[model samples]
Target: METKIFAKDQIDEAVALLREGELVAFPTETVYGLGAIATKEESVKNVYKAKGRPSDNPLIVTVSDEKMVERYAKSVPDRAKKLIKHFWPGPLTILLFVKEGSLPTAVTGGLKTVAFRCPDDKLTHDLIAKLGYPIVGPSANTSTKPSPTTAQHVYHDLRGKIAGIIDGGETRVGLESTIVDLSVETPIVLRPGEITPEEISEVLGEEVLINTGKVSDKEIPKAPGMKYRHYAPSAPVVVVDDVNDFAKIDFNDHIGVMALEDELDKIDLPKANKFNLGRNLVDADHNLFSGLRYFDDKKDITQIYVQGFNEGQASLAYMNRLNKAAGGHHF
Candidate 1:
């Protein structure tokens, strides 16, 4: 199949493709998402096939507004409403009870709950509004690969596999949305992103539990990244907790270092072998995946050493993705 690249304004072509049960990738603040109309079972299943994603790993439904969510969600709790007022059209995904038969099993992963988000991108919102229903959006890259923050990243990994890509340029957040499961009595964050649990707690005026335990292989993950390895490159990644640890490693041409600008200056590696992750945690969050992909393009990079931050000080979302990419390997 031919893979097309659409301009940000070219929503008609992408929407038409989706209407024909074809998959098209759309952008959000967090990441570019492979979109399939949520109600179309065949299209939704093809999304899993396209990404080689596990069938049981559910997808998040991308909607245009709260009304779209109300159409499918059994009931939106007051807490969810409060969160929506604060975080909707941003990087927050709310998991809610689904009305039976409202969405395809392929989308819900046969679970009674479904995740929904209204992206901040105007083009994406317009596309969804034009389509007249929600689209199941998982990160556009092939499963287990670094999530695509740019359209070129999507094209590199998924060209010819999906119908087309709506190029909305680079994503802002550079990570997935914070997923809060409101289906249960006590809201638990199934995944962390730009929106922290503390921020969510403050908005809802209640305690939000962060699920840190690994979901077993025998069990289906309630969220996309929970049960699988994700955001990894071809090279092995080592998390460097202390910048001073750079002195301990025997530097070689095959090693690539990703760290803050100042941290890179302290390292002895060649300038070509280092990728700057910028000044602070927010910059690191935005640059993380791009840095991983940068090294992937360098065939000689056998391993990657990335800067790590304390769980308390760093964005949990950034650390969560880095931990997965590194497979918990610390330097």
Candidate 2:
């Protein structure tokens, strides 16, 4: 099925579908979001069904600005406000307590709070402004699948499932937004994305707590994509402790190596697929999924090997996605 492209001219129709409790994939700086009206429980369920996402994993609502966030959430912490001033309209999402029954319970997964962000794109901003309602939006992909960076990726993952897709070309960040929970006095990093925790601290003057372990089955989360196995591919991928460690392992022919510039030239394996993630982590972050998609597409690749980076601001988000994709397949 051919995917419909909705530009600014056709935004009215998109808004109409949303108002009618229909699903639509729209652009954001981080990625395309498959959205449904947050107040409409039945409509919000369609987002989960369309992407095959789990009901327990809550959805983030996309708004126009901080003022709009106030409508759904009860209070925005001072730290949250500071962070918003620094990263709003970008790849950062703040989690706060919701007004009692302000939004549908489905949007919060029966939790007391919700995640909200004011998108940066002109089309998205205008759509949110015109709709006058919050939209439950998660990355436009199936559960455990790589997040879509381009409109084609969205169509590839959710073409017939959604009513429409706004093709705003490729996303700028090429990753999901940085999710921080401010419901407590101190902020916690529920999910790392393009924005770093250090950057958040610099703006708020407080340390950020990052959640790494899997959440318990009984526990509830305020933000979306918190505990899911995200950005995974069909092929089995592994992340080694380092490039030198990868050299110790031997595979006959169906192996691929993804690495940085320092390790790229050092490792020499014959007739094996190899991808250089660039000299630094920034380029690696941008190209990581594209490289995985390329390798996953190849019929000959049985397993892909990766080299892990040191823990730091530049490597945090990139490593988070890589580690999830690897799932302890590392050598």
Candidate 3:
């Protein structure tokens, strides 16, 4: 299970691994992705094996730009086009109806829609264009575990499980992409990431339905980071209803507190460690999982407590990861 870190100049060797129907861990602006040729059934299968991902959980296709988007999808509606004009080369992933014979059934989980995005990262764009195909790029980590934000995180989680590793340094955004489903009349937010529904609505002059935020069977997602346990750490976690409530808890064993920078001074438990995820939602969103990974790695912390953020644009993705990490274990 040895994981090797290849320089950005050596990314072609990683692409060669994908061309050979193997998986490689690489970086995107959002997070590290386990990449495989999206059209190659065997190569896509390797991504699942490498991450131990479930067959039912589908993968997202990463493309170079909007021109490539037309190659795989049957059609991009007007709404989707507007979104593309605004959000491509960023963290937004649009779900389009897959064209016949364009994508393998396994990659879509036998669904009619396929999620695709043009990443903002230079290395990721170069790799996709060089490989000359859309790639199945999922977060580079084991399923239901903390995502790999750094090359070492990938090496630690995916070593021996994949063919190669491309080190592009730490990810810019420590969260996954914002996924919008354009198949419906009103664009539905399937998964929230760095992009917010508010921003989408501002452009379209209408509200986007956020379906992923609800805890219901009908709202179950057809993509990764949905309908499954995710971003969890080894120790048990508790999400506090409010920052003031966090102060009431007694700290006996070494405690780990997950809070905003503003609340850091508010909680005063002795013999404790803290990871301040920034006071602003953007900074918090960008470092949520990496902070979780940091606390999860610390040997002294016995239990982790978290405080919820106010609902807003940047807070959307932050809450998603926190909910998954808390997993209903709120105090």
Candidate 4:
């Protein structure tokens, strides 16, 4: 299959491919998502085949608007309405009880609940609206790899397998949406992203639980990135908790270092060997996957050393992704 790259204005082209049950990658504020018509079992299955994603792991249903979610979900609760009002069209995913037979089993991973999100990107919103249905959108990269923040990154991991990619430029959030499971009695955060738990709690006017425990491999995860080793690259990654620890690393072998600009400057390494994580936490979140991909491209890089941040409301999302990518290997 010849994978074409569509410009941002080419929503019609991308919609046409999706209409034909062809898998197309679309941009979101969070990350690029590999899209398949949510109603079509075959098309959704093809997404798993293309990305080498496990069938047991569920896919997120990406919609154009809040109303689109009402079509597939059984019923929207009052709490969900609060969240949708504040966080819709942004990096927030909500898990609600699915309408029976409304979506394919492939989309829900045979579970009664389905994850839904209305991406903030105009091009993707237009694409979903034009199609008049939801699309099953997981991060547009091979399973367990860093999520694709750019169209070119999607092409690198899933070039010939998919039909085409809608190039909407680099994603703004550079991470997946914050997934909250509303199907339960009390809402729990299944995955952390740009949206913090505190922010969600503020909107809902109640405390939200963050599920920090690991999901065993034998059990199916309610959200993406819960059960799998996600956002990792080919090289071994070690997390450095403190900026001063950079001096402690043995630089004898070929190594790639990723940190904030100030942290990078503190280390004694060549510019060519260092990948900057930008100036602050937001910049670090935006540049995390790109930095991982940057080092993965260099043939000489054997191991990667990434700076870790103190866990807090602001830094939780970044640390979640970094710890997973590093596999908890600390310096």
Candidate 5:
């Protein structure tokens, strides 16, 4: 279980490991992904077992380019094509109907549709290009853990459990990809990410539905990051909706406060170790998990309080991560 750091130049070794049914945690534009050959059943099952993830939680398949989508995916809907044209090699995952027996059943969670995306990172793109096939990747951490944004985060959670990690660098988006279901009549967004719904709506010239709720027993989970209470850190987390409420609430001296840059001064706890996420929503999305991890590392801090954003497309994914990190406690 000695995890090696496959530096950028060493991706060929990473590809070799993937081909041999060993898991490799590699960087993506969105986050570091625990990758295995999408077509290999043993490899895909190892991905789930490594993270202790539920078999029902689906994994997204990463392709080298757009054309490769057709090999595993039955067909890409018009709206998906338009979105991929604009956002491919970026952080958008499109759920398309899967070709029967083309992928390992573990990769799809026994579902008919497969989640696919082309990562923007050169190291990732080149790695997949060399492999010449799809790699099924979920976030490279234990199940329900904060998605790994850096190679160290991957190491922190999965060092001895996985085969190796490709240390391309810290992830750019620092969140999961925006996931949309294109197999159905009207496209539905099962998970929000860096790509906002408004942007998707404008491209398709039609409304995109957001369905981030939990799935039913009778229904299958359409995508990853949808059914689980994911992104939780090791500390106790609470979400404060209003920055103004910071002045009214009482906090201990050892508490760690995660707040927007504009509202850092608003938190009245004199001894609170404040971490500024950023002035706007975009910064919030980028720094949310890192901020949570920051607080988790501080043993002196007992409770970690976070500032929540008002509902909007820009803050949609930010809120989703924060809500889960806070364990659904938002006030």
Candidate 6:
């Protein structure tokens, strides 16, 4: 029930805690993850409870390397193998045909497929490798809130609810891993991240479909950040095609606008507190979640207006997070 930062030298103790079925919030290259040994159902349950996540909302398991993939996945198709060869130990997560009894039901959410990634973080890889099993760790934050990119965010949301955090400092990508579904014949990208669809297609030497359609009510979430309002801050975010139009509105609550660097001069909201997203789309991706959380901390701001970025191969992940946070609404 106690919460504190664990130094790098303490990974062995963290591994011991995981092996004993306790949850440990740790860093990954993409984001901080609340981890537990994939084989332990009770451990996975604690993870779900800590994040206030639904049991049916599956968890992505982290492995040390591609060699450990087969231990959890039943069939790694040619496409998956090519993807692993190209993007493993990085930000890509591939959903595969889960090996029978390879993982507990809690990890897979009763689905026949399982999503797994080999993170680029040394501490995370060492923890997984030392434990001798895959560890199921989703973003270490409360469900539907901004996904924590730093250990401080984890400590804020999950301090007294679970175990200690292994502060590996800030995550590099600052977004969750790109998730691809390989269970079917043609791979479909379930969630966009740093690894774009074009990159995946180039790696496999074939076109991969990007599933950008609306998720229906009856559909189950194949990955995290889907099937829920996610990456949201305490303030409600509204996406607008142009920030100039927002100048026309008169609202009672304090207004906050996230303005793109190039278009900052065009925005005419005199009273709005503006946050700049750099001209480079990559920088926008880097600052997206943290920017949202920044606005959330502005106590008087109830409505946050975000300048929408056109979704493309490079900007897919940034747009995806914004779309979910605003429920795909464009004002």
**TM-score per candidate:** 0.98, 0.92, 0.93, 0.98, 0.95, 0.93
lDDT of candidate 4 over 1-331, digit per residue (tens): 9999999778899999999999999999999999999999999999999999999999999998879999999999999999999998899999999999999889898899999999999999899989999999999999888889999999999989999999999999887889999999888999888898999999998889999898787888888888888888889999999888888888844899999898787777788899998989899999999998898888788899999998587888888888899998999
Ranking by lDDT: 1, 4, 5, 6, 3, 2
Q: After superposition, how far is residue 287 of candidate 4 from its true place, in Å?
A: 0.3
TM-score of 1: 0.98
Output the number of the lDDT-best candidate: 1
Residues 177-257, candidate 3: write the lDDT tens digits.
999888888888888888888899988888799874544454435667777788988877788867778768996557888
Can you write out model 6's per-residue Cα lDDT over 167-282, one digit (the tens) per residue?
A: 99888888888999888778889999999989998898877999877656677677776676788887888887765666665645488777677666666555346777778777
CA displacement after TM-score superposition, residue 183 of candidate 6 (Å)? 0.8
Backbone atom clashes (below 3 Å) for every candidate: 0, 0, 1, 0, 0, 0
Model 6 residue runs over 4 Å out of place are 246-253, 262-272
Give the least accurate 10-residue stretch of model 4, judged by summed lDDT.
244-253
* lDDT of every model, 2 decimals: 0.92, 0.81, 0.83, 0.91, 0.85, 0.84
Model 6, C-alpha of 62: deviation from truth (Å): 0.6
Give the distance in Å from residue 291's predicted Cα in candidate 6 to where it truly belongs: 1.2
Question: Which of candidates 3 and 5 reaches a greater lDDT?
Answer: 5
Residue 20 lDDT in candidate 4: 96
- For residue 238, model 2's alpha carbon misses the true position, in angstroms, by 0.5
* Candidate 6 vs. true structure, TM-score: 0.93
